[model samples]
Target: MGSVLGDLLPLAVGVAISPIPIIGAILMLLGKHARTTSIGFAIGWLGGIVIATTIFVLVGGAFGDSDSTVGAWIKLVLGVLLLAEGIREWRARGGEHSTPKWMAAIDEMKPLTALGLGFALAAINPKNLMMCIAAGVTIGAAALSAGSNIVLVIVFALLAATTVVIPVVAYQIAAQRLRDPLDRLKVWLEANNKTVMATLILVIGIVLIGKGISGLA
Candidate 1:
């Protein structure tokens, strides 16, 4: 269980620090319907992470043993894809950073819509989805007991949703006090999004590759 958690920590952090979702949460908090929208978004985000990771863990479990060659190959492939994505992000770092069309509509979004958006970003977004899949594969392949799997999934989901949850909860506690800071954070995240993602993905990709190699050996 400890080793499994070790493998999952970086992947959870990868999902946690995703700038776009964090930015979206900030936008929701700063919007007129801050409380409902942010809460909905947080719930959706947590649910998405849990669902996606759980599904992948099941898939990984179906692949036979934890240390199977097939699992190692899957990790290797995922690592390569992540590495490629990181390089692409690095190359595009200086490109114009525009507000996504969806973000522009945040102020007008209903609670349900906010929930769906949060889910989509966490489950459907390629980068986040990849990390979740990797984490799932790690957990699933570990062949842990059912209780252990549940615990790991919960841990992963919480860690992944922490960034989105914090802003929402904090705003609920002290709405006015968080306004300026959230805005500043949103701006910094927007500006440095590419660089941060590039660095993060590259490091995780390398780690996955190493793990895959070691497992195969």
Candidate 2:
């Protein structure tokens, strides 16, 4: 269990530190309907992570056997994909960085729209989706008891959702104080999103590759 959790930590952190979702959360918190929209976004973000990771966990479990080779190969393939994505981000870092059109409209979004956007970012976005799948595969490949798997999934989801949840919850408690800070944060995130993601994804990719190689050996 400890080893499995160890393997999952980086993957969960990868999801948690995704700049786009954090930026979205911050934007929603600073919007007119801050409270409701941010809360709805948080729920959707959390649910998306949970659902995506859970589905992959079941898939991994279904393929589990008396061998570790299959799991290691999957990790290696995912690592390569992530690595390629990281390179792409790094190369594109110098390109024109503009506020996404969708983000420009965030201030006017309803709670439901915010919710859907949050879900799409967490579950459907390629980078985050890869990390969730990796985490799920780690948990499922461990062949732990059912109860243990559930606990691990919950832990991973909560950890991954922490960044998105914190600002929303904090804003609810201290709206006036948080607004400026959140706005500033959103700006910074937008500016540095590519560089940050590139560095983070590259490291995670290397780590996954190492783990996969070690497991296979």
Candidate 3:
């Protein structure tokens, strides 16, 4: 179990450092329903990854063996998609852009609506979707007991949810002092979001392609 968790740590880290969620959480923290909204968002974010990974694992098991070749091919295609996205983000990083329109209205949203938004971002956003799928593929292909497999999936979801969880908790504990630092982080992430995402995606893509080839071999 520990070994499997160790192997999936990179994916967890990638998901944890996801900028949009961090930024969105920050925005929610500064809103009227800061605590409730942020907490709901965090729950939805965690739930999204958990639900998506669970479905992938169950579907993968139903379709074929754990180490099936189809899984390898799926990884290969996803790897290529990641690489393309990386290149696109790299090229677009240099352009001047306005803040996303959705962000402007975030402060006005109720907690329940914020929860749905959080789920959508984590579950359906292209970059995040790729990472979750990659993790699912890895888990689905590994040789492990069913119990261990589910445990690792839980760990993945928890680790991936760490970043968003921190700010929400800290705000609940010490909003005044934490505000400056959190705001600084939000500003920095917003400024370098594309560059950070491009680099991480490219590195992960290369690794996935190598893993896929090795699996196919």
Candidate 4:
């Protein structure tokens, strides 16, 4: 169990990034429709974790345990970057940009389309992938971690889904109960999205950095 936990902990932490209020806010603001937004969010979150883990595996596989140390350092770097991103979000002011064109088109997509969109996002997101891979290396248990296939997949999926699923529920509920307010809130979110994004980024970054550094030292 302890070994299982060691393998799972980092991925869980990475997944937890989604439910973060500021991060949630940013995700909400990113898409025109809830489905697309959620898909994008989930994809982004899942991808980051997967990439992180993959990177760790590659490095560790090629150079042996040295990759673990590098992974620790990488984690610290990611943490710092997130912190900076958060600060930018928290401080951002005025109208900056609209949802990217691709996202807007996605708003009209069906659920399966949304799901596919999300899957792709998760598959490709560099940060998400790198973060997960880095976390794996940090665990330092290639064989033990590798052996628990079912458990690891479940943990990864659930944890990653949490970031996407929670927000979708909240957004739907809010849209239903507070229609006008929801509209207003969405507008407000769009207007000040950067500040909120920066704030979340900063928080995530700081936490990652702290954890990474602690692990490294």
Compared with the true structure, what per-residue lDDT tens digits does model 4 show for residues 27-129?
A: 4434456545565555554554455555554454454444445655766877776666556556554546654554546545555555555554455554344
TM-score of each: 0.97, 0.97, 0.94, 0.58
Model 1 misplaced stretches (Cα beyond 4 Å): none
Full ranking by TM-score: 1, 2, 3, 4
Best-fitting candidate, scored by TM-score: 1
Residue pairs whose backbone atoms clash in candidate 2: none
Model 3 segments more than 4 A misplaced: 63-67
Cα lDDT of all candidates, in order?
0.91, 0.90, 0.83, 0.53
TM-score of 1: 0.97
Residue-wise C-alpha lDDT for candidate 1, range 1-217, written one tens digit per residue? 9989989999999999988899999999989899999999999999999999999999888874734777788888889999999999999999986778999999999999999999999999999999999999888888888899999999999998999998898888999999999999988998899999999999998998988898799
**Which candidate, 1 or 3, has the higher lDDT?**
1
When superposed on Cα atoms, how far off is each prediction in RMSD?
1.1, 1.0, 1.5, 5.6
Weakest 10 consecutive residues, lDDT, candidate 1?
62-71
lDDT of 2 by residue, 1-217 (tens): 9989998899989999999999888888877889999998999999999999999888788767676788898899899999999999999997897777878898899999889988999899999999999999888888889999999999999999999998889988999998888888877887889999999999999999998898789
Give the better candidate number (2 or 3) by lDDT.
Answer: 2
List where candidate 4 sits over 4 angstroms from the true fold: 1-67, 91-95, 110-113, 126-130, 139-143, 166-192
Writing each residue's lDDT as its tens digit, candidate 3 over 150-209 gives: 888999999999999888988999988887887888889999998998888887787778
| 14 Cα displacement, candidate 2 (Å) | 0.7
